[model samples]
Target: MKKAIGKAFLAITGWKGEGAPPEHGRYVLIAAPHTSNWDFPFTLAFAWAYGVEMRWMGKHTLFEGPKGWFFRAVGGVPVIRHERRSMVQQMVDLFTEHDRLALVVPAEGTRSLVPHWKSGFYHIARGANVPVVLGYLDYSRKTGGFGGLLEPTGDMRADMDRVRAFYADKVGKFPEKFGPIRLKEELEADEIAAAKLAS
Candidate 1:
């Protein structure tokens, strides 16, 4: 039923799916170039089409109200951003407790432009000893799907380079709102170097 619904939705929307989800029992799935709200529904449809059940974290407020049941039923996990607790640690613990868990995270953290991507996905995958699955939505081709699994080796720059390469050709709904895929620390360093050169 879900697979049929997913296929129908994609067909009606004129979108195509590519690649496959990770075959591993446990992994962190990170989606990128999330520059529009439509990315969520499109991603959900792709997940259903592929028959991959994934749990995704969202703002705690999204889990409230009458519609909360719908969100929870569809594998939505509420995350309290204001809480001091380490989200990466919490995710790692969840991975530890569950025999098979696929936690999906939007590395961009928001549907707006930012200097760099949040590293929570990398930290969570590393701490949990799981691979990172590269999930993407390429608006240019009107296609959405997973790319491949990346094993985090604690080399942030090197790992991010591969991530950047994968998303290089992919276009977001709002391309202007999608910044280069780099770590915050690396972006800051580049800014500092540029400032020094100007001075």
Candidate 2:
């Protein structure tokens, strides 16, 4: 019933996806182009269509009433982002507790452009000794997809560069939704700009 409902909703909303089913593993699933609220439901529909059951984290505040019940049924887990708890430690605990689970996390962490992406996804994958699955929502093609699994090697900067390069030319149907990838030089320049502004 859940899968049928999700598929039907996607069809009605004209949401299209092109990803292969996610494999079962202890993985950090990173969804891209998270530029809108609708991405969540769209991605959920796509996941359901592929019959891939994944547990994803969201801010604790989003859980409420019947909606919360529904999200829980669909494998939603609340993450207290503001807590002092180390994200790496939390992921280690979760992966340790749940065997062979795919913990989906949004690498961008928001619908807006930032100087850089949240590194928790990288840290979680490394700490848990799992693969990182790069999931994408290319609004340009009205499509979504996932690449082959990637295992983090603890070299943060190098690993991120590899990941970014993989998706660089992957055109989306909604080009406007795609954000610019801040290159290493761009990151340093942004930091310098921020420092100047602060002074």
CA RMSD for every model? Answer: 1.9, 4.1
**RMSD from true fold, candidate 2:** 4.1
lDDT by residue (1-199, candidate 2, tens digit) is 6678768877897767665755555678888767778778877877777776778886677787668987787788877777888657777788999767777787767677655677777778888888888888776566676776777776666676778887786554444556665434547866899999999
Lowest lDDT sum, 10 consecutive residues, model 1, at 81-90
Per-residue lDDT of candidate 1, residues 1-199 (tens digit): 8889888999999999998877788999987779999998888889889988888987889989998999997889887777787778778888989888889899989998987899999999999999999999999989999897899998888898899889899899999999978988778878999999999
Q: How displaced is residue 94 in candidate 1, in Å?
A: 1.6
TM-score of 1: 0.91
Candidate 2 lDDT score relative to the true structure: 0.73
**lDDT values for all models:** 0.89, 0.73
Model 1 RMSD vs true structure: 1.9
Clashes of each: 0, 6
Error of 2 at 55 (Å): 1.9
